[model samples]
Target: MPLTFEDLLARARALPRLGHRALLGIAGSPGAGKSTLAEQLVRTLNGEGEPWVAHVPMDGFHLADVELDRLGRRDRKGAPDTFDAAGYAALLRRLREERDEGGEVVYAPGFERVLEQPLAGAIAVPPTARLVVTEGNYLLLDTGAWSRVRAQLDEVWFCAPDEDERVRRLVARHEEFGKSHQEAVAWVLRSDERNARLVAATRERADLVVRDLVGWPDRHGRPRTGGEPGPVGTDTGC
Candidate 1:
């Protein structure tokens, strides 16, 4: 049986503080609400008086438009190969080691959707942050560049939603990002679906599996209980 969102939160909060830092990876299919859940967790934890939480997204490591063009992978922009996975892993390692010594700001890269380029130093993870919540599509991917990422995290949570809902959200997301409805549907069926299948297979590796009930509480803000809610709608660019 899968745990509810609240169960996942409690599990994360219970992690022992490491001398270095804590890295929490939230992974899921393309439209399975991983980014939304991650953001909600950070916000909720901060609001509840945990101020040391920060976010470092994998999408931030996507290659620049020119590089993608050179590699001829622009059309398949969200594919695993489209990102600089090794660089991302290196940054995670650095984050675990670099304390707040000398007030040096740890600059991390970020991907720009509208501009379709990766900008270095777009995000800075301060040393004061004790909990880093990183979310993406390939965190648990077992092959290639993604394999290194899983080993760097203290814990990993996999989000699972109904397939119909996931597809609906993906289509909506694509359309919201300026794709035509037809194009969005096609992309969801062609690219996003493929990625989702790959992601779904990694659930067994997660420390916890979260099933977003339809009417469940706004697990981030207040407390309520019911069927799982519709998938969380958020555009964290992952």
Candidate 2:
């Protein structure tokens, strides 16, 4: 009765409908491994060939610092209201439409952790891409425009790991991103935890609750020097 990693992969591999694009959303609390799983799914599915699966993370929608400062919500950067939810939904819709119409390449934005800014058109969804894999902390959120995100997605899976492990990963991630241990620990408790609780509240709204983490080893076994989180399907970068 469990959805193994392989099962998830199989389901993702089969998501595209006849001549239409498929949008798969991964939702989870902070450090729940959503990004990791999405990346792994796309990577494994694409194998060594051309990429048919494209990764479009919701982090790109995070409000720029200037905007957040203007809104006076900079302290709560990861909160639901801190992102351009409506814009994100619009992109999802466009990605699907472009894929379905077999039109020009679809360009998506990317988030830069070091600068804590969103780079426009940083990610490209090729015309050949049939599946769009997206992950974020608020995919299942029902607030404001967030509710519309679910409509654009074919399926949304919730990633949930042990709370303690999630916290550990979150702290480590912050440290890897240049925050001192104390600062990382403090930020995790003060900020990330709040976001995590909000995200956890939406778990029931997801199509699947993924609890297992593939591994906890130094993800990608790479030295933890980068602030950006990548396919940690193998870090909380999820």
Candidate 3:
């Protein structure tokens, strides 16, 4: 049977039960809905209650544009090397330590979409949070500091939507972020596609492969997969 959103919710809800706090990693190619699914899980789990689920996206660890320029890798801005992977790993370790010791609040950096920069001390994860949902493109990569990242995650899920739909969403996302249609298409093909291929290669490492997360119910409550289309917002180009 195809996995429903409820099944994903149940799986994510069970993570915190394993220990004091659990880290859930969502990894996927560009425009595969990793951020969207993570956001929904955190929102639905917390409900209208005290907010036990906190979202800590890996986008915050993205290297600043200036740093990328200095490193002469600005053209491959979203590639794995364009991020502070080690710093992100340290942050995850800190989150686990704080969860175990019942320590003070931990602040995480956040990415400013319009400015395309990492903002420090932007997200606060309190000790009350029992589950931290972090999503990124390279969480399942088994090389370099990314390997340390996978070790920290309790379970990692990979988003695998239809390839054509994913590409469309990627192009649209670039346009939404202030790029011309032609420019968006060019970037998607030249830069994002390369990163996407790298991300796809790590799919086998995920504990779960979600092939239909972008689907939704119709007016009659029928399940639809990759039939709906629109802007993906923060779901892509992260």
Output the number of the TM-score-best candidate: 3
lDDT of 3 by residue, 15-78 (tens): 8864578999988899988787788778778875878999999999999999999999999999
TM-score of each: 0.86, 0.88, 0.90
Model number with the top lDDT: 3
Tell me the tens digit of each residue's lDDT in model 1 across 98-201: 66555456888876766757788888888777778999989988898789998999888777777777788789878887899999998888888887888888
Worst 10 residues of 1 by lDDT: 229-238
Provide the lowest-lDDT 10-residue window in model 2: 229-238
Residue-pair clashes per prediction, in order, are 8, 2, 0
Candidate 3: Cα lDDT at 3 = 65
Clashing residue pairs in candidate 3 are: none
lDDT of 3 at 5: 73
> Which parts of model 2 are misplaced by more than 4 Å?
100-102, 215-238
